[model samples]
Target: MADQQDELRALLKDSGEPTLERAIAKAREMVDRLDNVTLNIAVTGETGAGKSKFVNAIRGLQDTDEGAAPTGVTETTMEPTMYLHPTMPNVNFWDLPGIGTPKFKAETYMKDVKYQNYDFFIIVSAGRFKENDMILAKEIKKKKKNFYFVRTKTDLDVTQEAKKGETEEQTLQKIRKDCVENVRTLGSPSVFLITSENLARFDFQELVNNLERDLPDNKKYALVMSLPVYSKESLEKKYNTFKKAAWAVAFASGGIAAAPVPGLSTACDVAMVVPFLIKCYYSFGLDDGSLEKLSKRVNKPILEEVKKSSLVSAIADKSSLATKIAAKLAVAGVVESVCSLMPGAGSIAAAGISFVTTRSVLLEGVKELHRVAEKVIEMAELK
Candidate 1:
């Protein structure tokens, strides 16, 4: 009770509103925005610059994945094709047509692609940064949007240089220096060296960090939540974001009584709790498809390893069972069943549970998911 009160008070303070009703409205708005905010990222470059692969990677899909952006040495994208994130449909990555061709001027290309639609732009280069890439950066700058220079296929360079007796670090530093010097005229914009096959390697993390730093709070939240949990650092960051969000969810669910039950209103609380945890489960890469993808990528039976967790199994099972029932009953039943099955979820029954009890249950679910996610990261050797 005291903890809920403290959270409510903090929420009210953050809301900057004097009245409880207004504060609650603001809180609900914040939660809604966090869940439904639209983030559009633009990826543009010359033909065969690995832009399509980068688009697929940012959306957590492989080139061969069902809805992955088409990749080839030939120019595959003819228009601005918007690929929605598999889980987060609101976050879209626009694969724009390549610039610097005989017909497409950099300035004209920006206008043709509708530059105003995206939150930011990423100009990719497979080898040396070209003059057209710099021109596009300046055009994006004039439009008042952020643009990043990404040099892809760094892994190939490292592999080829190894045979020449050049250290990986030496090769990386030389490439970075060369990329920087090439773009020195553009105020020495940072160039991220990356390989689509493995986003955890090279400058991908640095690129994500820069995006997180520069994006607006809501868009950044969407970006973070939508990204694949590839490393311990990323998993921990996602966990902390969920941890911070727990209070808002608790307040939102606890305050809104959806239906009048015998002892308490569990419907709305369950409604919010179930989906939030499910999103966490998917975001942590605990879902079947994501696990299968990871297993194939790393050649490890990761799905079987993660399924060993009782909590994970419970969540996955309950999520499967949930789709058959109506929304309220689905989550409500799942809550009770999960609590009964998983020792980590505590001993709270779904019936006759008050707001505080519901909040506690939700927190327990989040913690259990976090633990399973951490274990998966360790087992997969993702750091």
Candidate 2:
């Protein structure tokens, strides 16, 4: 708590915010921006290029999931279809109509899809980059929108080549060389080879890294928070993002005008804290659904292992409660015990909760979630 207070004081001092109220107002603005930032991603490719699958994968959904984008070998997307990220609706994935079709010409596809709506574009192909893919890239370039080339289905290619006695690395190298040569005319654009079935197996993280680099700060925060925790590295990225934002969230939710949480002595805004922690829970893949899917994939009792964390178990129980009243009750029941770990936390009132105390709670909660997620990745051997 002391360290957090010092950090916050230093931050406020350095920012030249003359008063605590001004600092709180600045923090509130940051939190609002983070909550409202929208990222529209446009994904386009030829028929059967795995565009839908890629969209689904990045959105952390399987094709059969209730809200997933429909995926198929044919032209599943006849027109531009918008699929919202289940947890982060502000981040949208637009699966555009397949290129090179008789009905859709590359020259007019941008206009038809309202190209300006997207923050960027992802052009996917199952095999070597085709002429249609190149044309789409050129068209997107002309519009001054950033675009990335993704070569999907690399897992199948590797498996088929393995049967022919070729090593995975050799097969990957050959495919990468082929993809680069096919698009050499584009002045050597980076081609990410990935398999939708397993994001951690190929260059999916690299693709995310590139996106993080290209996106604006607010949109980047949304993107990272919305991505599935596929590996330790990805989990770390999320942890760092949350850690960086914890101060702002704490200040925004614990300012002088904050309301007391129902059934708790603490005066901080439970509304904001609960939603932020819930987002961390889902983003860390600590939720039951995510754990169940991972368990099936890894043939292990991952849920049981993860639930060993008291914070995780509490959140899981809260998530299953039928009503908001029940959920808040559940949260109130656990927050004191969680916060008790910090010195003098038991004395803090809801209206009197200091920024340091609130920040401590938020940081501790995110840290525990990140720890459990790291353990899950380790248990699943997704290093």
Q: What is the TM-score of each candidate against the true structure?
A: 0.85, 0.86
Best candidate (score: lDDT)? 2
Clashes of 1: 0
Error of 1 at 10 (Å): 4.8
Q: Name the runs in model 1 displaced over 4 angstroms.
A: 1-11, 14-16, 259-268, 318-359
What would the per-residue lDDT of candidate 2 be over residues 1-383, giving only the tens digit for each residue?
Answer: 45545666676785478866787788889899999999999998887889999998888777877687777867644778888887777989999886767668777888878899999999999998888888889988999999999999999999999999999999999988998799999998999999999898889999999999999888999999999877788898999999988878877764442445444335344556667888899888888988887787779888888877766776777653223432343464534543443333333333224565566557766877887898899998887
| Model 2 CA lDDT for position 194 | 97
Across residues 12-31, which tens digit of lDDT does each residue of candidate 1 receive? 57658886656546657878
Local distance difference test values of all predictions, in order: 0.75, 0.78
Q: What is the lDDT of residue 304 in candidate 2?
A: 88
| lDDT value for model 1 | 0.75
Worst 10 residues of 1 by lDDT: 343-352
Model 1's C-alpha root-mean-square deviation from the true structure amounts to 5.5
After the best TM-score superposition of candidate 1, give how far the Cα of residue 144 lies from its true spot, in angstroms: 0.5
